[model samples]
Target: MSLPQPVPPSWKDLGKSSNDLLSKDFPFQGFALEVKTKTPSGVAFKVAGNRDAKSDTINGDIEAKWSDRKHGVTITNTWTTSNILRSQVELENQIAQGLKLDVTSSLHPDKSTKTALINAIYKQSGFHTRGALDIFKGPTFTADTVIGRDGFLVGAEAAYNVTEGNVTRYAAAVGYNAPEYAITLHGLNNLKTFTASYYHRVSSDVEAGAKAVYDSKSTHGGVGIEVGAKAYLDQAAFVKAKINNAGVVALGYTQTLRPGVKASFGLALDTTKLNEVAPVGPSHKIGLNLVFDS
Candidate 1:
């Protein structure tokens, strides 16, 4: 007999398809670029820079990582322009067959700010669990678990304030998965907010999704809806667009220039404000991203 496989996705990733389409590749207020390469010693390096037009400021960060596939260990460090250094170490399948552990720390040069966090995840056929603890700050503890079988999943998550001796947050989610589409429903913030998301792959090159959210704690208590679609123009290019109930529309186009280079363009406009007074420069926002990987 063949061994059964584990559940396809974890609780947090239940609605990732529609979420990524609606959230990713949206325009920003700045220009960003990133370059990644690997050295002969098997160390990976990434450098990223951003320039904000409104603030007229430039900032960047550099990250380096070393991984050992045989031992299942990885170490990474990042240095940012704000003089903060972050380091992380990850170990997989060291203690158990389906277990992973992560340790992360942050340090500031000029300030006394220091923080550390530890996380662990374990997965098996039909079950997944994760736990995280903050060591330096409130010393908070959080945990979540999901049980899945035959395309049905249910999960719950909660965070506790160790110092305060109280539960800070709790949420639950249920989902169903299929070959071509997935659907999920989540009750977050102690059941004060609810969200429903759906994703479908129409064809090999076309995809569509939608999400709806309702918040009982909001001042207006309204339901918000967003629909989006993505289509691959060809092997090297694709386009995405999404519109929300507030009349905000976002469009994105990405193209692979070469084997190691990619470029993306994004535009966003507020249709409700288009009839108002014209802005000084332009009434819409545009963003550009260029990436190179080797």
Candidate 2:
């Protein structure tokens, strides 16, 4: 008996380089699948006025790429009772070879289904500086503050690492989103964001990360910070956690299920100040995720 031969992990290597000198741009192709669900309790129950649980969603993203640092395309389909049905196709490319400039944009076809929740989620994520009490529990309510359906986003990123490989590196990016077309609703427009982060390899099995983020809108802007750690158990498994100043934290676990495929799941807990006086207690959330990249 030859025994079952284990397929070598590509994501572990795709995250790094082959020759080591670094070839940021190489032609590559891949495929991925995932089914995710989130349920809320405590604060979520209070804010959304839901006596039971939030809705469940199953989404899949199919993607193809030339390489880690090259151009590619992705198609995503999301299904939810609230969203009904939504799909997106995006194309991206890099320019200014030395400066790391890249342009990205996407198009929506069966769009209006999510007309109300898209903007709501952004606001919940701190769409502006003035924090709002935006919650995206499900399609049960027609939120007074948000518009549903058809939206588009275009953005770019640029980064040049003076020094590479774990010791230290800096990167910056900016992007924007807007409503594409709507017959009976309006979506927030001119949303902008920027991010900068540093990576430190504390040791062979561990690393630390720090980042600053800002987002701007017509009325206000938001600023936040995040910190995290990553640990590798071996060549096939790893785990990480990230926390923000607002008391939001996420823990993720991942492993290579096959040579060209990997899977992951993340659990998250978050609390927002609600832009009010008394602090709102943390809202608990549980989520599951899976990914496959060929």
Candidate 3:
């Protein structure tokens, strides 16, 4: 008997390239800094801050996590501009052979919201199916399911507002995967909006992808689009670049400084904003990231 082949991991490589492009465009006002440390017992601690030098604005958060083979817990506390505290906690466990459960709670000093999620997966004769439910959040619920065989997948999801007694949103997706390339199409808000993506591995060291989104309700002149590529220079270094329909371009490079340390830098520019008449060379930004492990 021949064994079934598993899906290729190249899709993640494609996503990494896109994420490098999107990081600098975060809705937040400024650049971000993050640090993480893991202990021998699988406990981890993290801290992150976002700062804008021009505005002199900063936001920070701290998190801690502990995990074993089958169960995990995490807690995060955030400090907003008004110095108000918000905390979130999550717990996850594998309850049975193919079933998993997760619980999360978001809390302010005065009030709290809680949610529970259940996920299950099954596979047989080359077919796989997974289903999940996100329950009890402000009287809201989301249910989703996915099924796949070989290299093709389809998924549907819907959300309901219990208090309002209405279905708020619905979405669906279809995807196909092969050794060298993959594509997916997604529809949201009862098909009023759509997004599609394609990824391809050009060679052993190069991967490229593009994404586009459209919304029928919007009066925009053109679809939102982005294209990106990532290349591995060697075992220790890689570079990425992306350009969007809005005339903004970004470039990033990451390198392993040593066995347990890594560093990265990114720069972005909006070419359309640069002109003699505008008196601005370009709306440009730069960011750096460093990671350490013990």
- Give the best candidate by TM-score: 1
Model 2 over residues 188-275: C-alpha lDDT tens digits? 2222555444445667887665655566552555767777777899999888777788886666777787775566555556546434
TM-score of candidate 3 to 2 decimals: 0.78
TM-scores across all candidates? Answer: 0.94, 0.37, 0.78
Per-candidate Cα lDDT values, in order, are 0.89, 0.36, 0.64
Q: Tell me the spans in candidate 2 whose CA falls farther than 4 Å from its real position.
A: 1-57, 61-195, 214-222, 271-282, 292-294
Give the C-alpha miss distance for residue 151 in model 1, angstroms.
1.1
Task: State which candidate has the highest lDDT.
Answer: 1
Q: Which stretches of candidate 3 lie over 4 Å from their true place?
A: 1-30, 53-55, 70-94, 110-137, 276-282
- Comparing candidate 2 with candidate 3, which one achieves the higher TM-score? 3
Task: Report the lDDT tens digits of candidate 3 across residue range 84-109.
Answer: 55554544444444334444444444
Which is better, 1 or 3, measured by lDDT? 1
lDDT assessment of candidate 3: 0.64
In model 1, the runs with Cα more than 4 Å from the true position are 1-5, 275-283
